[model samples]
Target: MAAVTAMLEELRDMVPLTAEGAAGRFAVQEWTPEGKSRDGVETSWHKDGIRGWIQKFRSGAVRVSFAVWIRDVDESGCFDALDAVYEQGEQALATFLPGIEHSPLTGHLAEAELTATDKDEFIAAREWTLDERVLTAGVVQQDTDLPVMVVVALEEPAPASA
Candidate 1:
């Protein structure tokens, strides 16, 4: 969850979409892309396991998808807005690749499409498979029966014990 949150924050900063604040332009979510208005964009991500035994040892790739919908009062305005958003989104994601590689993600942009279009709105989407190595799930336990040791020291040894 931390990784996802951080990634989303980074994305929100990189892109023009709005995830927080009053003048929000788009909605962002993890694992689900529903419940958002048709006039705004939505981002959803999921983990897809790669075929290999070693995948169990490391973090698997995460497929982050963006669903963009633009709306306007007029058909022409809507089409223009959709085109602008789509182009900006494409460029923003491309510019974000270098940062992704330096962060927890390793892969590049994989796919993109304008999945739907209508008179007053359009839907554009893009996907990137990130090679994240951090574990987002599971837990580890340590044996409580193991021996324990504690050491306490004071600065200057408490003035040499006065």
Candidate 2:
């Protein structure tokens, strides 16, 4: 979730389109297996935890896929717009290496491709994936042994009254 949030923040800052008359506006949404359309960029992510020798140390990698849909009057211009958005997104992720808030152990653009296109609606869908390792806090342990001691107190009784 942290990685997703970081990616969303990065993508949300993109210009969306690089064409005249285009909306130049976009939205970033998290995608699920059964999600509907909303007219912007949709993203889905999966994380895999990596096992280490140390039990307290935590590490994992997150793979995020992004989909962007652009609508324009000209078919060719729509493709161009999609290209621009895709390029921008790639650049953003590339610069976002080493992670964001979570301090990813490693980050890079995994794959990018023009998954789908629709000329009738002048819409294009570009999907890309980013792989990154999550940062985790270090664990510390301490042990100690000490000798035990006990003390006893005695009270003196007064002589019986005559």
Candidate 3:
């Protein structure tokens, strides 16, 4: 069951992640297929502790994700959370904040874009990015996988050839 509550305020219109096999690449964002690297090693990962990964898919898109513990890693709850957040983009993302007296964190940024200003009223531990489309990704989890980690990302295509 997706927590009986709504997702973070920062996210809602988030496009939930589709199901994937264990070995499947959970890629929703675009990436550089060749010339960059064939391995899925995202050296540009800014955030630590469950960092965001950049993949190679010829899209040059980057992925940023945040994790929302489904109270207790429930599959239905994970999908439910994804659905709720998917329905409300920024609003759901905003819901992600430092946990207070709440038992077990319901939401926390597993990924995000950097801030233009050195200081943001939101989560401060995260790195900032000039890209406005960073947090605008979707809420998705590997199908049949642990529901503890919910993924989000943004895509930026490479510049046109000269």
Candidate rank order under lDDT: 3, 1, 2
lDDT-best of 1 and 3? 3
In TM-score terms, candidate 1 sits at: 0.25
> How far in Å is the alpha carbon of 18 misplaced in model 1?
26
Q: State, as a TM-score between 0 and 1, how close model 2 is to the true structure.
A: 0.21
Better of 2 and 3 by TM-score: 3
Put down candidate 2 lDDT per residue, 1-162, tens digits, no spaces: 243334344433333211110111112232222222123322212222211110111221122222221112234446566455445534444343323323331243333443232122112222223332212121111111211111000111222346
For each candidate, what is the lDDT? 0.27, 0.26, 0.33
Candidate 3 lDDT tens digits, 1-162: 121112212222333311121002322232222222235343332222334334434544434333432222445656677555434533434454323113132233234455454233322223322233333322333444434233443333343467
Ranking by TM-score: 3, 1, 2
Worst 10 residues of 1 by lDDT: 149-158
Q: Comparing candidate 2 with candidate 3, which one achieves the higher lDDT?
A: 3
Task: Report the candidate with higher TM-score, 1 versus 3.
Answer: 3
**lDDT score at residue 15, model 3, on the 0-100 scale:** 33
Clash pairs detected, candidate 2: none
Best by lDDT: 3
Give the RMSD in angstroms, all C-alphas superposed, for model 2: 29.3
